[model samples]
Target: MSTQNYLVISALGKDRPGIVDALSKSILEFGCNITDSRMTVLGGEFAILLMVEGNWNTLTKMEESIAGLEQQLSLTIIAKRTEQRDRSNPFLPYVVEVVSLDHPGIVHQLASFFSKRSINIEDMATTSYAAPHTGTMMFSVHMTVGIPADIHIASLRDEFMEFCDAINLDAIIEPAQR
Candidate 1:
């Protein structure tokens, strides 16, 4: 059996129409399948994170063409080889949500909470906006974390709630539906 070759690529440039089209077309031409991707406009910049998989030769050919692609698309591209994540000590996925008045260090504090417990944050996103009616600046965080199966759910929930309370954040921790 042939092993799969995986490449993770990040492209950032000024936001524009057809960036995805151009990049994806190149991947298709090189015979690679885009396994995962996250594309978003951050301020004036368009950022992309993609994982593509193919056979060794096809991936190499694609890598060789990245420089030209960058020039054509006006993107700064970075690519690296990676393997599938190891899940030997698998985690039970949990979703965490937090909302509070906008302030500094919220993300950092939340990360510290999980890091201290050796929890893995698999995905996270945050946004700030004006609160409806009140017009107060509000911040919200959504994160997916990996909890070790050995950890007791009830105790973790209680601790997380209390921690949020101390920080004046309204939050919830629940098992991820998916």
Candidate 2:
């Protein structure tokens, strides 16, 4: 029987080309399969988070070589052993969209609202830009959320709308098409 090892890898460094190429080469050479990953530019830094799967021996080898990779790439790297996660989730998926004048605390407020209801925010991306004609600073948020099975969808949607209205944000909450 073959045993599998899961690893959570994160790296951050000054933004530059070849970051991904270097990391991918190391992972491939180490015989780890990239399962899921998110890479983005945050300010002047390039950040990467990935889930990799390999046999126990391969994973150990990767772990041992991570320090050298970090030094070579001038990155801050962190890796941790992770167990297989349960794929079954009872929560229903929903997409949330919000747009309004740019300001602080928007994400915090949304997180507070969801935490109060025991809802899980799975993935979210937010950006700020100037409105084409108005030249006003505008913020947009798109998020995937998981509503608990015990929650009432209609009531939750209504409450969310009310909260957004109070905050002067145009918002929409709808079932996500998977």
Best by TM-score: 1
> Candidate 1 on 1-178: residue-level lDDT in tens?
5489899999999999999999999999999999999988989999999999999999999899889989999999999988777889978999999999999999999999999888999999899999999999999999999999998889989999999999999999999997
Q: Each candidate's TM vs. the true structure?
A: 0.96, 0.94
User: Candidate 2 residues 79-120, lDDT tens each?
Assistant: 999988765769999999999999999999999999999999
In order, what lDDT does every prediction score?
Answer: 0.94, 0.94
Cα deviation in Å at residue 83, candidate 2? 2.0
lDDT of residue 18 for candidate 2: 95
TM-score of decoy 1:
0.96
The regions of model 2 sitting more than 4 angstroms off are none
Model 2 clashing residue pairs (backbone): none
TM-score of 2: 0.94
Error of model 1, residue 158, in angstroms: 0.9
